[model samples]
Target: MHKLNGSFSTGYALLTGLMLIALAPASSAQESKEPDIVPAGETKTPKTRVLELGAKLLQSNSPLKRFDIYLVGFHPMKDSPEDQMEAHHYCHQVNEDFAQCALFDGNTADANLNGIEYIISEKLFASLPEEEKKYWHPHNGEILSGQLIAPGIPNMAEKSLMKGKMNSYGKTWHVWDTGHEGKLGTTLPLGEPMLGWSFSRDGEAIPGLVEKRDKKLKIDTSEVRKQREDLKQYAKPQSGVDDLKGKFSRPTRDIPGVIDQGNARSLPHTTE
Candidate 1:
């Protein structure tokens, strides 16, 4: 919906390019009440593009640039190959799966990057009890952990879910579930798993696994700003939002000639 390239008026910066490059289709039609529309095959207009950690993408255009930088640079020990592979799958899944409800959501990679921002903003912040403010403190390294926000699944490349319980005493607790088993009912439109952000019957910001959040769920704008700041380091300099939307509107099984050797380096199975 938003024009991605114009944001990078100064030319493709490395992080901006990476974020654009990372753009993927939305996982759902309306995620936390946002539009995710992008056209596929349209090359990104990057502000900056860089190849880091063998292969990782980030964006700097959004307001939450800091989160962009942090996400890519985090975990210097580096993620295991398995973790990396799973991460990619989850990201890819987020892109494709968003198409179920609406024609499409914004680029999933962008959305994925925003996922951190989303958690910190609307989900995590609002979820926090007014008294438990320390946990949301910026100094806590754990705040950066994808697990802290929604540990249901720790793969940014995959869809996230949240679960809750009805205690014996009629109380409730939080549970998270990440991992996609595909969508329900082949007959459904965009029959991918109920992945990504979708409201529950109760109107809560339910992760895919969780059944509900609240009626007025919305992504936190402040968190969105911070994540954008952090993610700038890994954000793609290119503007792939248009391409991402196009690809989602009329997707293909695979692009055929596009060989992702970089991704394959970390994920052997990704090789064409």
Candidate 2:
């Protein structure tokens, strides 16, 4: 197991402070690319606002307060790879090996709560039944390709968090299709919940999906990927890496250190 270092503790403290300010009730200063369909309802009256204010002051929100880590990534519907969308994850580390995240379509205050994801370490995942393992997606590809990132924290803190999650897996279910980069999303969270999967190879994601996110967030995936090349030493052969291998519209290519568990013996764990 990869042990937690002091850097992780320092990062957690920084993240906690950021989350406190983020969770405060505030206006939507930043708008989401996919806006929620405004449901039919009457405008809030002064009486309603006052009542809400009282409830906010009196009601206990302790459970919601611990979701301090914020991450951004994209998910392709497991059954339909063509249907993909960006996901914003607000997570709480339940323990060293478990986490639960609330999924949103964007990072703004008005972002829609579209889904939920449960994350677990490789040790816990290994104990699951074979049938149940199919639902979870591997993390090495997402981490190594620089597609998954913690947006608001310092670079060192984010890297430490990602390193800790090198061999983890996530089971995600997106309950809504809030659209993609250029298109407008459904006004309502329609249809059955979609099981989300990771892009384990290059060119698997729809064209321009990752670029749009990088441009909007002002970060470079290439630089991030270079920074994480060293993390490949910790990579392990994981399940679900090849589940969608030939399913993408474009041709795909391998990323070093990411392979299916069936090919475990063929891959090297370290460069040396």
Candidate 3:
């Protein structure tokens, strides 16, 4: 036999290896399977499904409306000129021309009963005599002051919602003074409901209350104030306006009972 050259021997060995790879009993597809590929436009994860359901539920819930706001005022019988800041959570709904709100002392689930607020449409508010209007506070000041905030809402959405409430009037009465005592008293204080008002200016509210609230809610009241500058026209003018001038003791005819004198002096008044 002729002696094989090294080059030819190497070429034969390479060709044999290639043939073995091609002929290797094509491994059953089941033995080495590729990962299942999610077809284009057909992927849906558990998280996405959950988000869709949440959106649908939010759209279906119509009657329940909730907001967290701060009301500033004091006991009706107290003559001391001071500002009291009370945190309130309002769940209100409007049917026809009437609106009713359930008020809570704090914004959380553990919050206690503070009081209730009633609102009427502009037509209804207009029909009331001028004297009756004093008991109702204009919401424009509350809306524009950046003090009355609705938590868990986008800034633009909150502003749009407040626009609808601009002309609306609210008559709020506080049953519990949780700000002072720290807890809801065992029994509901017996007396006329203390009228609650909104902060109309920069210094009218408690110095740190608004700031603390803004921090907790991750909101900037200064930005809200800037956005509401155009709403000033809707606000009631301070000229001859007793309501914004620390004169909130007027008794409303809607709720029964005279102003209670004993509870007025229970808490020390803080000066404006």
Best model number under lDDT: 2
61-153 per-residue lDDT for model 3 (tens digits): 455533322232222212222536444545444454556776664544446666778866555777988777767755555567666755544
Q: Report the alpha-carbon TM-score of model 1 versus the true structure.
A: 0.17
lDDT of each: 0.21, 0.81, 0.48
Query: In candidate 2, what are the lDDT values of residues 217-262, reduced to their tens digit?
Result: 7778889999989888778788999999899768899999798988
Candidate that scores best on TM-score: 2
Error of 3 at 65 (Å): 8.8
The estimated TM-scores of all candidates read: 0.17, 0.86, 0.55
* Count of clashing residue pairs in every prediction: 91, 0, 0
Summarize candidate 1's per-residue lDDT along 1-272 as a digit string, tens digits: 11112111121133344345454422221134222222234554453333442244353443333222111101100111011001111111112111001112222444221122112222233355656532222212212112213211122321111111000000001111122222211112232222122110111111332111112122232352344333222222111111212212222232212122233344333211
The full ranking of all candidates by lDDT, starting with the best, is 2, 3, 1
Q: List the residue pairs that clash in candidate 3.
A: none
Candidate 3: C-alpha lDDT: 0.48
- CA lDDT, candidate 1, residue 178: 22
In angstroms, give how far residue 9 of model 1 lies from its true place.
34
lDDT score of residue 160 within candidate 1: 14
Let me know the TM-score candidate 3 reaches against the reference structure. 0.55
